[model samples]
Target: MSIQRLIFFVLSALFFIGSSVWIKDEISPKWIKYQKEYYKEQAIKVEKEYSAASSAKEKELLGRRLASLKRPVYEVKQILLKGDYSWDKRLNGDKVDRCITCHIDEEKLKEKHPNAKEFPFDIYGCAVCHGGIGRALNEKIAHKGIYYHKRQMEQRLVAAESLFEFWSELANLTPEESDPNQRLGMGDFKKYSITGDKAIYVGSKKCLKCHTGLTSPHVERWLRIKFKTFELVKEAPDYIAGNEGYRKTCLKCHTTGYDETTGRYSEEGVTCEACHGAGEVFSYFMDIGKALEGQKIAKVGTFGTPYNICGPCHHTRNHEMRLKFFQERGADDEWFFPQHTTPYKTGLTEKGDASKSLPKIY
Candidate 1:
């Protein structure tokens, strides 16, 4: 061969070999080295086939076949800190998420829907309502990193027996003499209570951390309804002043916290886990980008949950439970209507939903 032709051929061969190595490195998952080698072998095989091609058309066909081979492309961001993140450049560079990759439909729905477009997923984040770790990339880490699922969690409650035992250390006090501050169910008993390995959901304490009485009607409304239960239960012949059956029943229809005695959680009012399922199990089975595009998935907490946050309480529990309580006590349901109502789920319920209700994060 001529000197110029030999040099050109050598350079071309080097370029081809270098490109194959680079391509394998870029695409390989790298857990196993052989997978990359397999791809390299396939590349070499194709190159050999191309070399043996007799005509320009055959070479072009081989080139097309090589191009058509399905290869997975992975895009990743090196997260140095919690604030470090990626953005979706295609949709206005608004925000970025692994969730968006799976929830394309929700992304479209949220982007396309008139009501949802204003409040994008990036702004609100999936964790607020869904209760999972938004910062995490994978299914196990993202979900496992969040706070324990309130419904399923066994929190440290001031057990009635434990309370009695402590109080018994002081004296055999009557219900009237019981200090409100020291009472098991009355005060912030969790401060004194010992947390267990198996945590269960205490009332709306988790919810009240953000949705305080100064801002919204959540705590105030709960207090009002809860007190009414006390007043009604006081009328019962078997009722003791400081004990908790009536309050427990009030929680039945009033709040969403789990009642261990009753297998069914009838009317869970608005709370974090009420809308979202337990935090630990949250995962994406498919592309999250589709979900955002308005396509729905069953794995996500919002749609996947067995209970509807509003439906059970609104349609049945709110109207039925309090009425049942009154009827059993020989009082008419009409009197209780003013005191107990079903307006809990009719309007907005979150801190962000209410004006200036959101807590300052700084």
Candidate 2:
């Protein structure tokens, strides 16, 4: 072939190859950048979701933030293991002195059990239950205790009362009766009757109504603090569960009444009457301008007040439910309630056991 003809053929072949490459290369660097941006956006979304979740249980699943951001465990070991040792370490956010200074309970320990061994009580050590990085000398690791590996909130330990309450709820559940594959028997409410006044069990909705437009600063602060994922879920509808605007967030505390449906609410916000006791009895006098006059309102504690109500749930301990009880019962159920509160009497009886519920300490 002539030189010009050969050159013409090579140019045509090169043009075809270039076209094929362009057709195959669908993904560009810009496309990769867009994907990275997409993931970053997703991460932000999960963080917001975690922040918006009201229930602790919900928070666990939704929590997408890095572990370091969560609340740090205020460890007692760092202080107790330190030279100036003590029993009760009343820790302040990651401070050795804060804990040791308050919990020098060796004097108390000695007074109570003269024969018992001294400080850094392995059984009674702050680290045993409340975790922190024990070996760390720095304030962050020392005071902000150890991470709870098995549990959701890796930082501090779950409150004892919270654990107990969870157990109590579990005890009340009847998966065996509800599910065909279930092996265990259902829990019974036969031992001690649920004796609280039916009037006291107001649902969360009643609280939300007044709370929504309440004038007080306290009410305003609470409204602001309450978690909601309306905005994020609005864009990603698939991620959300309920209606775009209205949904139940208040049910976390203001539990549903016995007659009421599980999620349904008769009122809005946490009503004053619910916390202060059934206004049916108390409010009668209050309406007549003599609330404190005729008869004292019926309540759970001695004075019929909130301190009693909040203590059982708020001032809860770590081992809310004593697992040993379940062990003693020989019940190998996976859904074991921690031995929180007097379980048996409150319809949370262990398998076959008939122990009465403990007295309310409030």
Candidate 3:
């Protein structure tokens, strides 16, 4: 053959090969592999159940399930989420999430999200909380910016500028007037953001059930002081003399799992779960004798100092009585109330002068 003809034939062959590969990929996408694996596993499980069935009724049901799994319909499963505008009036219309196509194990997901009824996966979709490119079929593209776990999601929520906008929208105030850190401390932002796994507050009683035996001294000290903050606030001259509106403001800091919009709290006073995180998933892991797994979900020993956890309420910013009292006693403008007596600030770490420390929490 002539050299030109040979080059032409080679180029044609390459073009045909490329086109075939593209067509094959389009026909059987990445998600198809995952679906096939899931169905295969399910079929094996059903087959085992069928063999172990003691009754004809159970065997008949298992046989049907096995048959259905053997010839499963493989298709792109999607959740059509009805979207709304954000705080800045950004239109977020209908979204198509194909995440469920690959993550087809509904039972496993149901276990992870015990409160699935509240924020149904079918309605709200995965991207609403565990953010990612929901519509993408390719694994790499789909999980581009995905939050694989609760801790990552919590960090994202904490760092998000949208939290400030959301807080402003909820409080009927401007973004400048709103405090995202304060919202984080009050559990208002998290309550509105997500509701499953570590997001649901399981109360301090759940924490005490385990920790009381482990760290008796710490738990006892915490119960004596932190647990009595709500009662103390109630008996205080400010809370007693103030109106209903003023008392409502105190609940934001004085109580655990306070919902600013609903005007309700999960429990009175600053509990263990308040400083840590919601204890549902954490408790689940602990109960299953998976202490290391539980620690990953729990926010134990995460906060270096008490300032981040305590500054929301203990500071002199909004405390009119405390602020005035400190000012009258010739305190500096930067000086915060409830001063630390010891060199170790709030029993967390050693500092030169605890009183000189600035409020970095908010």
Candidate 4:
């Protein structure tokens, strides 16, 4: 090879390596690490103070104060709230305003409420809760709600609880299911869910059943790639396949479930048990078409709990759990799946049709 060709090839190799790291890191859940530390510290400080206080009156007052200052464990500042988000706001309109400026003492809160100890870190900081100029005292600039601000701050503690409940349900288990050693559910609970179908377990076969001839960009892409779950299994084998010859590769795209008849799918693919929770319990409530009849869609669908529905699968925190793990299926890896080419599958429950609710933004 010519000297120029060699240099070009080396540079290309470096670029590929760099790109892989960036994508992996992007999918990894590092941001949560920082936020958890911050919350835990605050929670402990307040709990300690609350426990030590001898005066009941003082404790009551402290508890009230903490309740007012407490923020949600998640960072969703937009989806849950309205009004222009102005981190610059002093107190009014800004989501963060309600607590930091007013809470004279929060340490007493953590001490008083044992539940507070479960939070990831110390009390949420002033700037953390309120979006406005963190230390700014001016009301006019600080209270601005819209410009450059997040729309939701989750003022109600109940909202956080509700969100957690949704997530717990999505994992097909609850707080009881949380084992640090094992991978939980599929996505992140923090970001928005793609494709209105909150539940991805319906299987591509089901999707292809109705959408076989549907020619959309996404369909075209799937067809072009010949992205059949069975074919992928044939290409690269793994433990998910087990002694019976099934593959774990299916879990990469589908949710999980247990099949008593086959006994193999009992823990693989986008089974109903994964997103809708274990049917062993919730199956009674979920019948086809029942979700649409009610004013509030059944809790089993994506809209039932959009955040929790999307969070588990969307946010790829750990490497072993990310989608790329599926892409890296081949034994020698002679062929690699294109990172950007594979589009996520979606259905009716992901994000509701915006057109169904409002006029066009443009």
Candidate 5:
């Protein structure tokens, strides 16, 4: 075709597409309204059939069956995964959480183990004990840890700050070349950029709400920093806290904290967040808006932490920093501290079975 004719045809098609009712290839507003009306009719028809139900069980079953009915669109339909569920509860006077909506299994555990007082899904919500953005429904936002994010933000900030401290000629370089570390001050790193489902371990603040020194001594003991003037602290000159390898690899599991000694919070120590990951993501599958069920709970470690999670550190390896550091410092692994191949499973019943719901710290 001639350039002029081809150009004209292309322009004509573009104009038609832009002006069409199906903007962005989605259904038209008129068609959506029609679909809504059709669903409404279906709902009414289902209600009429439900009225003839004989018993409560029958009604319940029928209700559940009807709930699965797919909603139609202009030219398509979809099975709604138990319509926008939200489990909300009052933590204190003002604090509220909708975590139970997705973590319905957590709610069910109360029934599973009637004796366990701690699993009170109402009095104690998920986000309270486990640190996370409570109000966030999105997977990434909800499980973000304040401790990790803060450090990440600080690192980004510090790196950006350092880039400008030592400088070379920038008169003729391009934008990318001018800045080696890329952009400076892109707002808060945690809030704006770092998009991971990191469980913000809430230290012991939430646990302390109900538990006291009498009830939870181990928890309290772990959270504290007691540097006795009499006793000498273990010195690791090579494995300094802020060193490149230590910061990157060692402390990801050695302990949960902003630094080597102190935790994210002053009272923060190795809480549930240490072993069990951020509870919010594991409990609630955001895609389905439902709590993980049965074997899924065990696999995900939603309720209980498995020993396998600690394999990254505990598992034997060659040329590992721990081994090399120990060897160089004339420290014997067996002498200084006996290294276990696997972290012993804690909080188990006498029979070695899972404690159902109760957390009996072994």
Candidate 6:
């Protein structure tokens, strides 16, 4: 062979070898390093426990744990999540969550996600609650578009910019004191962030089943007025001929469990769960004869006034129009209207009248 050809072959061989090594390192990556450190720590921990072990059986168990830790499997760890929990539903198949590869401390994760039954880390995985690329191995790629806090995900669902516009428009039209920039439902959003499943609304039928007794006259009254909001809007000539934007804006306040992104609602009209919150856990507790527990879990506004709860829907524009409409039709007694002027009371009960107090918008 020619010396030039021989040199070319040698260079080609070296290039292939270097590429192989680079690929191997990339495949193993930083997760392997983390696993190695974790194993070392575990081995040290077991060794200390073994040293402190007075009983023969205890020492034996500790010795076995130490041996296992010493010979730790340093590979990419992943939880094979059941079902396609991916953001894009087009990508069908069980999701592979490689988050646990680096985040190997299961105990630490358990501390953060306390409810193992509801959101099993093995089944649902990290990406379901905390948004991220579950299948990606590289740290940056894996954590891309990750939600560090639950509020971040909730705020995304609420579509804060759109909500701000809605609130601002209502505030401008109303005669009530209002701040457009205030965070309206931060506390309310916490109830939503419990689990992905818990975020769903169970509808008013579930609530009404328990609250339908003659003793709960307040609930009956609410059903008469508030529950008729969507019907009232639909019957309105303006709403019947309104543009999509106008209809959607009305639905935001009129309907329960309205999703701004999807432009869908769980139920028509402001149902029991609308102000009380999503009724999965609450209803579950209530079903088992634990009303107090259910109330706490639901985060029901029992102590405080219903100003914050009612303010979102009971703004000046809606109040003035709805009141005038109802009164003109001789249905004013049936419909509970908001107190448009100052010293506004949220007419939640017979005693307390509904108010035109706009929700704080920071």
- List clash counts for every candidate, in order: 42, 29, 0, 60, 1, 7
Candidate 5's error at 19, in angstroms? 20
Compared with the true structure, what per-residue lDDT tens digits does model 3 show for residues 1-362? 99999999999999999999889889888888999999999999999999999999999999999999999999999986554445463335555678999999999988988657655678656765676778778888889888888677655532224443433333332122256544323233333443233357888888888789999999999999889878867755446656778788788888998877679888999897777756665565687676765665454324555455566665545566544533444444334234342121223223334434333111
Compared with the true structure, the alpha-carbon lDDT of candidate 3 equals 0.66
Q: Considering TM-score, which of the candidate structures 2 and 3 is the better prediction for this target?
A: 3
Please report the candidate that would top TM-score against the real structure.
3
Task: Give candidate 4's error at residue 45 in angstroms.
Answer: 54
Best by lDDT: 3
Cα lDDT computed for each candidate against the true fold: 0.40, 0.37, 0.66, 0.39, 0.40, 0.65
CA lDDT for candidate 2: 0.37
- Model 3, stretches more than 4 Å misplaced? 1-17, 84-93, 114-117, 154-255, 258-362
Which is the winner by TM-score between candidate 5 and candidate 6? 6
C-alpha root-mean-square deviation, candidate 6: 20.7
Rank all candidate structures by their lDDT, best first, as comma-separated numbers. 3, 6, 1, 5, 4, 2
lDDT of 4 by residue, 1-362 (tens): 99999999999999999999878745553444444555666666667788888999989976765564465353322211222345553235533223333232356545543333322113222333233453333344445541232225332212223334444333432133355644344333322111111222334444444346753665667555534433444434333334442333334344254333444443333432344443321221133433222112223345445545555544434223223433333121112223433334323233434223321110
TM-score of each model, in listed order: 0.24, 0.21, 0.46, 0.24, 0.29, 0.43
Considering lDDT, which of the candidate structures 2 and 6 is the better prediction for this target? 6
Flag clash pairs in model 3.
none
lDDT of 5 by residue, 127-246 (tens): 423446655544456667633333443343222222122111111111233555343221111111112223344444443454465457755554453212001112333334236645
List the pairs of residues colliding in candidate 5.
145-200
lDDT of 2 by residue, 1-362 (tens): 99999999999999999987666543332233333454455567668887788998888766634343343232332232323333465433432322232233355535644323422333233333335534443445445744343243322212223322322332333233455433221111111112111333333344445446644675566445322222322332122333422233323233322123356443343444334444343333344565333134422222434343444334334222333433443543232332343433323444553332221111
Which 10-residue span in candidate 5 carries the lowest summed lDDT? 165-174
